[model samples]
Target chain A: MSRKLLETEGPKWVAQGIITAEQQQRLTALYPEEGRVVGLLPLLGSLLVGLSALSLIAANWQGLPELVRLLLLLGSMGGAYAAGEYFLRRGANDSLGIGLVGLGLILFGAGIVLTSQMYQLIGYDVTGLLAWAAAGAALTFLYQSRFLFALTVCIGGIVQGYSTGQLSGFSYFTAALTVGGLGWYWWRRPDAVLGGVLASGILWQAGLLISFLHAKITWFFIPAMLVYAAGDWQPDRPAGRALQAPPLVAAFLFTFGLALYGETDTYAGLLRPPLLAYLSALLAVLALSAAGKRARGRLGSLTDWLLLLPGFYLPSGLALAVATLVVLYAYSGAVLWRAQQEHNPDRITLGITLFILTTMAAYFKLTWAFMDKSLFFLCGGALLLGLSWYLRRAAARALPPKSE
Target chain B: MATPLPLARRHRLVLLAVAVQALFIIGVAAAGYATTAWGRTITLRTAPVDPRDLLYGDYVRLHYTISQLPRRLWRETNREARPNEPVYVVLQPAHGAYEALGVYASKPAIEPRQAVLRGWITNSWRHGLRIRYGLERYYVPEGEGRKLEKRPVLLVKVSIAPWGQARITAVNALAK
Candidate 1:
């Protein structure tokens, strides 16, 4: 049976030739047919690590002082390093690095939390801040993990820069320099790229949030565009399936940011400027999306419409604009249902699209709908329930019973 | 043009660096907490200071208790106030070194008869330190003092460092 299976796949493997005989041998040895259960270990390890992190965050039985808790967090980093070393000795791959880097992240988070808890702990020299920054950079280097390093550096930069009253786009630009430099250094490794993406997102959020707090309106739109650019830049690269999600997620976020700003502001408020600029900006995005060379069909269509949504703010267009989104979402759901029935397209992809559209419509109707929130919620719930039931049936029909 | 380091070596270095940084951050935090004996660090839920500013919208103008000072008294200490002037005060610690219990504004205060008498500010300084943030500001008009007489006053009692820098020793908040 093994021989037959190998014979069938061997030709394809040979034709592809991406995996050499030695690599194939290694794969087979690691996941021998009878003992393939061992491969589950990494998945199990990852789950445990994830759970521990959750537990650490969720624990409410508070006793330790903030400083003591921070010290314990530092100790946990030691444990992570030890775990990484053990994994290495046992010949594990980058997942070990990922886990260790996660520990570093937790520590960094703890540091930030502790500072806030300890009062406006200020007056640290640039050299002092850089010490922690260097440590964060070191974690990246140790794991060859650019993501954690980039994250550390970005947060450190924000803390340092913000404290000194010296934050700007130029600062963000400088931070991005690290992403390119370190990202390029780890070019062969996807983890590094992943790191860059995360770092960039954090920095973007930080800048936007700070700007929001300061009532600095101009920089508000930067994050939205940054997310859009991230999405636009992806799909061209050889990013893995996991990494592919972020760009699309970023795109959605960009649209949401625009919608949120637009819907929240009163028409006469000065804050409306950011919302207006965002609306115009979305027009350009819509045009680019229509240019159509990029990822086509549903994603592009949804994005284009999403960008156009801010036009809802126009008093004359408000009713029509909301109705359009609702209709589009309903149609997408119908299409997804049809796609599932035909077994010709990605059902989950269409379902997600339906979800986003539905959520957006609900948000607008609930917030912008004059004094009839209950009615809007009722309709939204009914639609969601109907879609869910339809999906269940479609899912049941598509997936057949498996034989052991 | 940097050569890509081997994954193993890179991983080791990154781990070490993160660990070290984490240690240093914790240390800094501990040090900050310890210094509370010099002055209290307080975060208030605040509202807008300018009544007209509130009329424009609902956001608040946040001010730190530490930043609050009798302007005339502060000016008098430095003689003439520059755009960025440094003022020092002595404090008593009620808790840790970082926590402030109360403060004595050492700068001279203006009096009708005394003219510019160098008087140490104490109870009045604590009253000024209670510059409210958040909903508290909303409830009180700009000219009005805190409505409740026994309101919680956040004070980090502190002493001056050798170089006349503020060093917190204790934090005392009036019980609700």
Candidate 2:
């Protein structure tokens, strides 16, 4: 609890005979007031100074002699690293230390770019920027900082983006580094936030790779689901679920889009990959995911895979749309059913939201063309109100009575 | 999670890592100098782009005359040229600037006067292929890029290192 809460409530507890005033005084002493606001003033001041310095150097960058510019780059980079080490050794402000170190890492990248630009150098390969990502990975390992791990993931994305978009070639090595370096780190550490960040970073690279190849977009799911399967193998439940969330969201959105647009044969045709190859790859991932779920005794979550059903393979018509909607309802219903069984209030709320969304989509899709405008609104409103009431009542009955 | 390294060991590693990064940046600079000092220089012609389109920040985007070449210059006849495939272009001096003599999937032996510059095929079509040599961007001194944009045509001096690195050394307007 916060010191303010304790200060306001401690005397009342003593007055109520829950504890003596002496005990209250001791408890109050347990939570020392933080000097965070005081600490922030100097940080803000330093940030302003740093930004001013940066602007001045940037404004005069081209005017400066080459040697001076190079010296400034290296000198400032070294200074940041030294300051980071000093603060880290001091141990009073670890985040600030790590922040400075991260700054050094960023400056290293800027240095590489600036140095190349100085002599009008053009590198056909990614070697220069790859070093930046490698350094980031190394720092993350050395410091064991989530901040650095996330930073490395971002660096990997930026490098891959440049390699593909500008250089016109996919840097498979950079992709491998992110998956092998940062992925291994996340696998060992299993942080929920980092897991989410890592998964999204990997997905971003995978998306770029797919675009670079000009492959059918459906091929994207292969790498995306590979990420989801990796999450299944993670021993930490919360972190694993966090990692799985992005791929699941992507699949859900794709399936929802299919429901809305599957009536167009052209759209459905674009989604079809070479059937045998795609199915085999997807099935292999499914087997891996199933095995991991079984090992972790989380087989109930297998319902999440329902969204991956290849409804687009069906001939594009009302049939495909209806099939997709059925899958959505089944998946959301499974979520609700499982949430209620586990008495997880958060999951119940999510399930309710998904169910309502699916209902709205289904109602709009089936009725919008034929129904009168006023009647359509009237019916949608009434249906939503009735469905919400039923779902909330069901939720209330499933959850235990709250004591507070 | 792997246990964090001991503080002293971590410090040493950080020092090593930072030093390596610094050295890498220096190496890039050194390569920039090396390419110009110990490399063959060739002049290529650029069709002037719109002045507004030319100056982007401190760099001017150059469209070299060799940027697009007839597909017949593609030496590999067995397979279709793929986008983003790295190809070697042999250049021979014609008039004041080098013109593409041939495009090969692999580096081809060139006569003493001919130079091989590496580029990637950005797009390939029935009759022609568009290539990017990575020398398309010329970083200019502050406010200098705008002055080059107005020229109808310009000659860019590029140095191609023997080790397959290439860079733009200078750009000048074609003498009327």
Candidate 3:
């Protein structure tokens, strides 16, 4: 129904004879053919007005009494909400209504702060931030507004950070709340800004996951690999709840894992639990992804799937690591192939980005062994140029013909 | 699926939403009013570090002088107070002002002017118990807060409510 869906897939379906040209036209027309919206203007105006209003209070005009200041803060907050509701009731200019709600939310928080300052009130900022975030999130649920949800998530992270002592003392309950709340919210409304939920989940995971890994740093990669595998697993094709945001989470996790790997050059730590843990977890993820594909009978044959997942039961950790990386590479290659087959531009874009990240990480990581700076740069430059040309030509050849 | 509320029903919910937010603001004011109207006023020495928090706009991070309470200063108590738990501190007359006489894990029944106040047990060492009444941080105007930081000792006016919760009402800088 979106413009991107029509533009990218319409021609592909037409070429493949999936739908008649007339049926395509009718299907596309079913969506409202709205022009680009001017929603940003009202939102921008409201932000400017909100900032100036808060700034006016900040000036602390001596003549204004404390009671009057409190009244002004309350009056403006109530007025904004009332107006926002009235505008929504009209069922026109919804952006303006949303903007008003945002305004009211901001002012409401500012009121708590201003009153705190006015009376020199006591309490940690966490107390107020949590309250503000809760109120904002409630509004988001009430209205199903993604923007306000995004706003609340940002504040909620602050609450998490402060409560846990800059996340140094992040408690188990906090981690559970972050994962649980985001998971529930996404399940209820997957379409509402996935950005916030992903961010909160990652902040909680990375903060807690890496915190426990003092020396066993590479183990951090498993959670992300699990996320990617979760997304990559689907019976018919690569899809599921994992497909929504886990791939992106996984790719970044892969990048971080590589960065962590690159930080070390020791051979001693390679056989440890972190490594063994990572290898086993990586195999489990690979097996899960392969199992889904195997069930659907998409990956050619059972032997082929066996080739993709090699040495899963291997006694040595090193062999398992090698097999896991091979499986990872195969899965990414499958993602690219599937993206091309389905004409899923988003998947293709993500695949390409991950490839570039992995390649760059490898290049820098390998070059780190060079003793002399000049030698490192010389080898790195050559590697970059070679990989650049090779990747460019491969990409060009992989694209669909322009005739389509 | 959520059935759409009737128009009148929607209006009432919206009003309720606004009222809830309004009530939060009034709650803050109500606390302030209670302190000013019925609570006793006391002054304590204070110091400032950072002057601004980007999230909450302008405010100074205040560190009160009473933050460090010696463990020996604690009177005969029923039990040891845990770290970061709200405990009542009994303030007695000391050096033209008041200092903590004893820190209790729970609120202690007190005389009319015994001055029982609520404070978090920041820490307790063999030497002393570090207590921070939530009134430690005093919010002030932008550049103005920075000016207060220069003074070695700034007098902080605290209004303690009938219920023991304290609020910093004012900060007075000492001129050299």
Candidate 2 lDDT over residue span A1-404, tens digit each: 88898899998999999999999888889999899899889989999998999999998898898999999999999999999999999998898899999999999999999999888887788999999999999999999999999899999999999999877789999999999999998999899999899999999999999998989888899899999999999999999999999999899889989888887888866799888998999999999999999999899999999999988788999888888999999999999999999999999999999899889889988999999999999999999999999999999999999988
Residues A95-133, model 1: lDDT tens digits? 665666566566565555444334344342233444545
Roughly what TM-score does model 1 have, to 2 decimal places?
A: 0.48
Q: Candidate 1 lDDT, tens digit per residue, B52-166?
A: 3332122122233434444433434434432212223322222322222222233433222211111122223322433111111121122222222223343333332222223
Q: Give every collision pair in model 2.
A: none
TM-score of each: 0.48, 0.93, 0.65
CA shift of A18, model 2, Å: 5.9
TM-score of 3: 0.65
lDDT of 3 by residue, A48-134 (tens): 998897688657643368888889989988888888887888988787788889889988988887887677766533455456766
lDDT of each: 0.46, 0.91, 0.62
Residue B12 C-alpha lDDT in model 2: 93
Best by DockQ: 2
Candidates 1 and 3, the one with greater lDDT: 3
**Model 3: lDDT to the true structure:** 0.62
Candidate RMSDs in order: 13.1, 2.4, 8.2
